[model samples]
Target: MLKIKLSIFFCFLLSFCFAQRELALKYETRLHTYLTFKGSLSPFIKITETDARVYKSNQDKLNDNPEFIIAYDEIKTFEQLVKNAPNDSIEAILKRKGKTKWSKKTKSEIQILYENEDRDASENKPLSGKRILIDPGHIAGNFEMSVIEQKYLRFVKDSVPNLPVDSIHISEGILTFATAQILKKQLEEQGALVWLTRDDNKTSFGITYQKWLSTRKQIVLDSLLECGAMEKTKYNKLKKEDEKTFFWSFFRDHELANRVKVINKHKPDLTIIIHYNVDEKNTDWLRPTDKNFCMAFVPGGMNVDALKGINGKANVLRLLLTDDFPLSEKISDLTVKEFSKQLENQVAKKTDADYLKDNCISSSKQGVFCRNLALCRLVKSPLVYGECLYQDNKNEYLELSKADKTYYGINTNTRVKAVSDAYFNAIMQFYKK
Candidate 1:
């Protein structure tokens, strides 16, 4: 009796101690955190049940509290940013205009028709047929002595640069720039008028958000980061008025204002902004039994198909760009299906994969995905944000980087060609429809 009582007392003390700790972290309005897990740390929390998965598939018992935990090492928490940020990161990132604005000027350079490689003759080739708008994304810094004061005021005195720290690597500008280049080449070949959002060189990287919001700056400090991790110092350099710039900028620059300007100017029938993805639950791709770099996103809008308003944003307009090829590979139209199917054959000839198993197409790391977020939601036009792959994983990065493309890492021609082929086929289908 005495021994049993002492054992029970010991167990109670351990349970009491374990219950004292909880996953306490903060999330602001638009901020998020993703945790990576490999083992059964599931025994810890009851609320995190859905995110937990067991290995070997034969476990009679499940780990309620996972042995380990992971979360995003955010330099700037969204709430801190929202509270003190000068401009909204999202908005500033997708800004339509630059700090140094330009007058509307048209330069008549040698232009080629979609069908023929030859430059357009001095003869008037007024754009007939469908017009398309392609936004490449991002600009580089400038070195003009005249505008130095203006630029310095923004970076030095401005509240936030929207996406601070590493704009060169994971920013929207670089990825969009790549996708736009491939898209432009392909769309032009098919004879569509594609007006890109940015250019290849630094001359058109757009104005830094830092400059735009220099007039009003606010600072945000992260209490969680380690020593010499300048998150706190970087936070204080901004003024107050830049609060809503992030969200507003993305809408205005990427979706509404910038796109509207292009549409009003040229009246494109289609518009697309290519992008990649980041998913924390990426073990399948990261530690793969095979090499498969795959993911997809859907268009956002109301649906007669289902009546769920969980993530509905009215999708604003009937965006037809969502249904554009390279954006969607599900292939609804017969003509496009046939066209893309043939292209799959070409892809198989050059690439090594069991293409037939995936219905002659496979954008999955393993099998088919039911929710293709980048392709489905379109309030205005048929628009979908086609994601290349996850950037955070090493294997997927290696596979996705197999192209002749290189951001910070070198890739082979095959990988680059594969992504190019997918988008190209997607475009061909849109025109066919």
Candidate 2:
């Protein structure tokens, strides 16, 4: 009897060890396949059976030393560490582990439990108590602002044969904001709490570009320089650059960071980033193009150069350890499917755009690609960065220019409304699953 009991105990231990090894293999496979853009093993990250180590560079790995070490079971604690010490180096955060407010709770802690409970209780309201965040890409409010941001579709009268409009001067930002507003309303009507990152004609900073320049520009530049995100030479050049250069450079990335900050703080169950696509080959967007395609981006696609910073490395680890990657893929897949079906646009193939081949990792899903976009990497929630219909496409431009509808006092076209409906349907399907 004693021998039999000992045999059972040893077998249990062995099986547990096997399970752990299998899980580690699974994670490593995911890391290489989905996260690494080049489909090669990253030099900065080393994974073992029990823990993953983040190295500052290949030299650190050669020394067999890591900057930060996170055990498999301590993923939740590591998450808290990063949040509490967003500016601190990963090594510093790990060193002061016990000093920080660490929690042993799982990733899907109180908030998710409450969301599930609310979801269970509200059968009639499919999205009841769910939180959704809508990020309208870009800060341009009008044609002039759009021109400054270089995100507008422009064409003179008769630029394209049989063009419906006398001229086309549509701002991508305006379209995104309109689409986000419509989607927010639709989600809210379905009993979800929705938040937009910015107001109409405004930026994620809660102000217009002009206002930000007048009030916060110097302060932001100083902070960027101090943080080493901007070099001193670049900071000096920015002071002399025109407003357009400023918007294109520092303001752009900082605003995106602001969006990420707010979205992470909101802790939304899902995030939707809205943008109108344009033909990458359409230089200057001076005229319409025959190309129209739909695509969606999720996290991953991190190259070697992308892992230069502590924050970027931390985010990569977060994505690898958490369910964000798979969930993002699912929702993005659904979104692209709906966009193709509703808009009568084809899902973009890897061959459709050069960037799609060179800069992204194509997913198994038809139109979903894993691109290392700013919001894609930093936003903590499962998100879909949607590039709907191409704004520079000939027919799409005419259709999107029609001011046939208005929602909440915002003027938008039927095409934009259709895009909103596509997103709404996708969200509904996501929740149904």
Best by lDDT: 2
lDDT per residue, candidate 1, 1-433, as tens digits? 9999999999998775454332222111001111101112222222221121111122322533222111222111211221122233323421321112212220011011111223333443332244666644334223231132111111121322332322112233444456566656666655556777555423222434444334222222233234454454444432222434442422123333444344334434555545544442433222312222343333322122321221111121112111232233343222223323432321111133332232123322222122223223321232334445444433433333324454223223343445455666765655554
Candidate 2's residue-wise lDDT over 38-94, tens digit each? 754477787888878878878988886786767877776565545434455444555
Scored by lDDT, model 1 comes in at 0.33
Q: List the residue pairs that clash in candidate 2.
A: none
Native-vs-model 2 lDDT? 0.82
lDDT (Cα, 0-100) at 46 in candidate 1:
22
